[model samples]
Target chain A: MSEVPNLDIIIKGCSKNDRESQKQLYKLYYSYAMSICLRYSRNYDDAVEVLNDAFMKVFSNIDKYDTARPFKAWLRVILINASIDHYKKNLKHNKNQELSETQGMTSDFRPDNEIRYEDLMRLVQKLSPVYRAVFNLYVIDGYKHKEIAEMLNINVSTSKANLTKAKANLRKMLKVYEDAAI
Target chain B: MQPYKDDIDQLFQEGLSSGNIPFDESAWIKMEKRLDAADTIAFAYWKLIYPLAVILVIVLAIWLWPGTSDNAESAPPVVTENIETHNNTDANPSSANNESSTTPEIGAKEKESYKQAPEEEDNAETDTTTLTESLGPSKISAENTDEPDVVRATVSENEATENSPSFTGGGEEYQSRFGGDLKILEGLDWMALDGYRGGEVEMTEVPMDTTREEVIKKSKLLFGLTVSNDWSAVGVSEFTNSGPSIGAIVEYLVLKRISVLAGASIGSRKYSAVGEEYWRPRWMDRSPGNEINTIAANCRVVDIPVNIYYHFAPKGLNQFSIGSGISSYLMLREDYAYTYNFADPNLPDTWVWENRNKHYFGVYNLSVVYRRQLSDKLYLGVEPYFKIPLTEIGIGEVDLYSFGTTVSLKFKK
Candidate 1:
């Protein structure tokens, strides 16, 4: 892991377009940005792309950054927007439809059982782009369905439906993992 | 399902959030390359825009300076006293005839004094009077019968002389037989007239009646077409979304100096963004490297503006005006497309997103307009305008403010 520098100095350097400060800033936030991007993206490669793009934006608009705000939060917002932009660009080919009827899942699963992080990531990646985006935005990011609807340019009901379907798909994937572990 | 669903969600959320994913070292190299490329393109765009803006400013300054001079030359002085007298005489012709018959005797006395003056010996005034008297009683009767023409001609002739004193004393002259005032004496120094003509001096009559009627008749409606470059005022240097705007408008002159304008315009705004999309090939067990896409969001807007203008000189050929209005924007189409690097070589890459249900926004504008009359019915105008958003354009919190210069061609009816 790269040692994080003082944010104020890094921001100032980035604002001046200094490559070393930008590289340092990118390294410090790399893991956090990757984690968020991965949840919103289809695969590890897509997550890396989102991370790079987000970092570029951070470096480019560093002058607008306020020192009072958390840099991580600001970086996360850019990543989310980048992810959505990616989705929008590829929306024409996206064949995933909103499942109208909610699917019921088995209730016998244990919550305390440990699951590998890689396994969880795989399950999350299996969900459709719309479902994954809605799921991550609502469940992990704590955004309301209305806010998600506005951000993604979709109806609130569609946002709710996608979240429900994402959870259902995850439950089924988790069942297989649980069975294999046993 | 509900009881276990919460636990499953918590497990996934905690698991995903806790992981310390390693950054790919190779991705930074690609990202740095893209950042460098973007910087070059941005610099090139600025290099083009800066000179264009400076040239436009200089051109506008040159055009506006001469416009004031043209307007000053076109606005004729208003003949207030003559217009009132003419209207009264037209209403009562019998009274006009009585005044005309008696005024000529006084005019004859004035003519004698005018001729006796040593300076008046070489004057053209004596010849004009001789020509009128030799035309006989028929012409005299005709002049007495129609008084307005005689008065108008006398006024026009007096106005032609630059150095002549006001018609208070030496200025009065009898109506010539030619139905016009006598010409000035020849010995008068023409140099005095030329010297006093400099600056904003009133040189001609306004012809109030004709001007009022012409303004009421010809200036009721106007149509115009405009083209401009628009950019955000608040982060002006940082904003790269400045775009071109085109519009057509119709104005109704509610009063001579004030008009109400309504028009529709189509314009676009663009911004650069970076994005990534995932692709997995059937041959590979793991996902391939993320494909970097440089995207530009192009937003097309349809705007309708309603404004009221106050003209500095509505009757003049060249006029300066200030106006304030409200413009409503309806988002017609918005698309995010990859501007660089097509991923698929074989399949025709149609990568774009069309957004719907876009909310309408409003902007308030203040503008200064300079119009130069090209002909009796056509005018060319340059308006520099400032616009402020009354409402947010989209979900974004940034308030969009813009300053632009518009060049227009207007037709008045």
Candidate 2:
């Protein structure tokens, strides 16, 4: 971390519209941003698109960034907004589908379960767009039900209902994974 | 229905937050291209707007300025025309009447005496001499006794009025008829007026050489002291301050109606940064738990300005001048300090000062000066000026626009 260049100096350079500084900043946050984008996007290509859009916005509005606040938190907000914008643009075809309620076996998996991060990401991506957005906004981003509703442009009950359905679907997938492991 | 909600949420939060998922390096290249495109668009808009804004300001300043060609041509012509008309109607008629009455008396008496007896005309000449002496000194000679009566009378009438001490009312008429010729009269000594019924005063011919000399003599050097309050704001920053400035200027006439002025001033302004404060790691300072909070700066500047002023009514007591100039500001001192809090109670309240660069900046100024002459050599004036900086003042941080009203006292020599 000490060997890495100072973020404030890099941000100042980016504020001056320096292309190299922008690239440096993008490379620094690329992996962290990609993880968030992947959860919101349908595929790797869509995630790349979201990442590009969010980074462009960050570079453009670099002047507004206050050095005192955590830079990553500000960047996270921009990426989330980019994701929401991407969702809204493709909303006509990417509408959430109706899912029937499923009853599944409750398995007590220890903390040392063998689920890789890649498997978790795959399962999260398998969820419908609306459920995935709500789940990401509420669960991963720590937004309240009301905030998630506002962000997704849905009511609180719909957000709560979507979170429940998302959790049930994940449980059904986990049950399948557990059965396979046994 | 969803007892495993907490588990699913924890599972995904931990999994996603911790994931260092690899992304294609080509995305940065694409993003850089997009950023470049956006920057180009922004630069294009700025390139268009900047020149347009400058043109608009210059056009507006020229249009609104008082001494512009339109106002100069329109105002002075109307005023001069009225003065000319008044002088022509009032002074010309009265002077003509005075000449008509007095000239006939002197001419008829000489004519009658000459016709009665050529020898006796000498006695009549003595009488005429006495009459002329009573009236004033006459330029008419005895040889003019043979000339035409009207011509002789007109000559005597003009001479009488020119020397008459009582003819103060004809001053403006004399001035109008013989432009700058009265400058000669200003050098002469004359006696007080006694009532003398005489002919109307005639206009005199003025020498062109003396007129130029008098105009040159009237062009005086002016020195002025000004005090003003400038309301200034940093470029695109939500911080502004009103500061006092004091200056002295010297003006010299470069043309008949244009003068060049140069001056120096000193002023100070305070600025504060706008935003929320958060603690970030400080690598430079070894002090424990140092957290940056508020940032503020006070800038002291010295300025030198060169301006060209156009006086609308140079001879009038109420003078309106419009000028434009450039000023160079030397940043004498910039105290840029930021407050930082320490998590340790043992560390007292602390502030760190940052070194500011760029000691000089330039600004363009447009001003309107309205002056009322308090005396022949003293004038009191109010100048409202607008200033736009050519470069940012504080490092790369801010540009400033200043509007000020300066009250000045000027002395002319």
Candidate 3:
């Protein structure tokens, strides 16, 4: 009873679409949701867009939230789905560009030997959107290549290829940073 | 594979797992605005009932109007066959089962029981959420249990990220971390572990003035094709004056049970009446009368009907709707055949073309529609409609009443 004492009330309030409960839910999960979105999105703006969109879905469909499942786990899934939706919606304008052509990824950006969260985020975001999505889905989110392929509407082989490409790019970016630090 | 492949994966998973940005107040404000625009999902009955009220008013007015009473008599007879029956079944099987099994005792039993195959549990990814749970991850709602470090994800593919199917929800470590949902704000006080964190590294802040596409679609559109036999039943003190009409319709639902439809159909209102008192359009020359002269009209018209409808959509494949609105008919082709009453009906001199298709706004149209779902996007429907002319039409300028039942194929978009 000591654990999550008010969570049931909050969930019930959220299910009824109480605005204060919705705000409480959004505030409660903002960090957790934002963390997930940032890993999949390209930048701060895109991640924020994805975050709010996911929250909107959460509020609209709270009644569908099965009481048996862990709420964090459910929220994680929604955030990931919202990120994919954002990616697909902007796929035309944000098609996979080469690392050099990536607009805001600056080579001059430097970090210490022990790369902090910001530096590490830039290293991952430096990968193209497709590669980043594949990496996030497969490596971080524990989705299989087959599952990722189905979610992304790509061939299984294509999913494997994108994961490979994402790893190689991340390795290259980390190497450049390491060489500069040395 | 590169030596750092696994290292790369572990590095990102570990790094991105725990940290969060300061909650931006603007996000909640914007979300509140969106919620305001599209209210919480209670179907507004007023939208559906408004159409019915309007139709009732019009029906009463037509019933009382002495001048138009003669035309109202030609309305197509009502077919009172039951449109909605056997509604005990539901549209979705799972929902039907849920509704049937949701007695309070069964509901309590349901919380303790799951239909999950036991073999599936052996394949559960126990580590999927254990990593995050150890990190004091947020967003939890659960009952207290002695087990502090339970790994709860089940093996269902659709629920790959979901917790144990039997879990009441939340996690012990997760709850202790935030202390409750509201403790996340106070948790932010301890959130300054790294000053350079939370996407603050030279990130470009988008202007608050930047707008998104706010014109989200509030309604769904349906396209239709209609083919029917149209009747001009003013009787002319005679009977059986009907013609063929073919046209297309576009309808969109503005609310749950209310829709506005507008259509343009090319229909002909043809009949033979006594030539003695036949009224002529100004553009036509009065026919040179002969012995035993009578009139036959073969007029092609384009009818535009706009209607507001209220529908009773049951949880089955069939939907029934009632609508009342106005119709405007354009004179497409008018050829008055002047016969000596004994002359050949096809005699060349007996036919005269008076005017081109003239746009004439004429009648009040009412329709009773029945539609069946053929497939997800397509619907098979029959709509029987009647038009009481507000103004007279054609060479006779008679109280030309039109009635028809159209078979239509509707596709929803």
On a 0 to 1 TM-score scale, where does candidate 1 land against the true structure? 0.53
Give model 2's docking category: incorrect
Off by over 4 Å in 2: A1-24, A61-71, A91-113, A149-158, A168-182, B1-6, B35-51, B61-413
Instruction: Report the CAPRI category for model 3.
Output: incorrect
Better-scoring candidate (TM-score), 2 or 3: 2
lDDT of each: 0.56, 0.57, 0.57
Error of 3 at B87 (Å): 53
**Which tens-of-lDDT digit does each residue in A36-70 have in candidate 1?**
88888778888887778778777877775555545
State, as a TM-score between 0 and 1, how close model 3 is to the true structure: 0.39
Residue B271 lDDT in candidate 2:
59
Task: Please give the DockQ score of every candidate, comma-separated.
Answer: 0.20, 0.21, 0.14
Best by TM-score: 1
Task: State model 2's lDDT.
Answer: 0.57
- Summarize candidate 3's per-residue lDDT along B112-210 as a digit string, tens digits: 232222233334322111111101111121222244322222111122233424312233322332242211110000111111111111112211111
